[model samples]
Target: MSRQQLAKLDQLSTGQTLKFNYRQNGVPREGFLVRLKDTWVAYENRCRHIAISLDSDNGEFFTQDGKYLFCQTHGAVYEPDTGLCVHGPCKGANLFSIPLEIGESGVWIDME
Candidate 1:
């Protein structure tokens, strides 16, 4: 596995997201890091129902209520902390989770 910094600790407040990219085993991939409450979570940007991106890089990942991660293209709703698709076509599936490392300096994603 490898570690790569995504953002500084203060760069994101609660309920905010930051988009990032990484290469795993020589394959390029897109991911996003979100700060929820005081915890940070991440997942691959790809939707479970389809290969399309969750937000198309528009950077809007939450529903109007800000209660869950939302896929604008397909109305998929995911639990922010677990990456579980709790609604929509992808129900019962989950966004590909990316492990994270948080520190005083920044946030990092562990890629394999």
Candidate 2:
């Protein structure tokens, strides 16, 4: 596994989600990072239920209320911190989490 630098902590604000690209088996894939309170959380952009991106448009993961990650595709609502699907088609499912590291310089992810 190799770690890839994601973004500077100062670049993200509370409740903000940023999209990132990483390579898997030499194929580029999408992931995302979200700032919740003072912590950073990350996950693959795909939805567990339908294998589709959580966002319908760029950087639109959170619901209108800004409380949960909402998938417009199938109405899946997820807990941003844990990636747990709380409601919608795939209840009891979860988003695929990507391991992340926070350093003094920036955020990093295990891209392997």
Candidate 3:
């Protein structure tokens, strides 16, 4: 795995999201880091159904009620626990996983 330092965990806050790019197979791919329940979860931003970004124009990718991550492109609802597309067109689909670990310093993107 290629090494890409996204950001420090303390730099993020609950309900916030940040975008980062990593080189995979020599191609730069974008992903997202979301702060949820005082922890960070990372996943490829592309939706499984149409390969479109889940976030809207402003990078806001959550439901109005802030319960789940909603894909604006096709209205897919993903469960944060597993990055599984639990509702909408891509039901049973799952987002690409990016392993992450947390510590006293911050969260780190596991590139292993």
TM-score of each: 0.93, 0.92, 0.86
Per-residue lDDT for 67 in model 1? 96
Across 19-98, the per-residue lDDT of candidate 2 in tens digits comes to 99997777788999999996999988998888888896577999999999988898999998999999999989989887
Candidate 1, lDDT over the whole model: 0.89
Better of 1 and 2 by TM-score: 1
The better candidate by TM-score, 1 or 3, is 1
Candidate 3 per-residue lDDT over residues 4-95, each given as its tens digit: 56767678778888887765566677788888875788888888989877885468877888888879877999987678988999999898
Question: CA lDDT of each candidate?
Answer: 0.89, 0.88, 0.79
Which prediction has the highest TM-score against the true structure?
1
Backbone clashes in model 1: 0
Best by lDDT: 1
- lDDT, candidate 1, 27-74, per-residue tens: 999999999896899888999998999997799999899999989897
Candidate 3 C-alpha error for residue 60, in Å? 1.0
Off by over 4 Å in 2: none
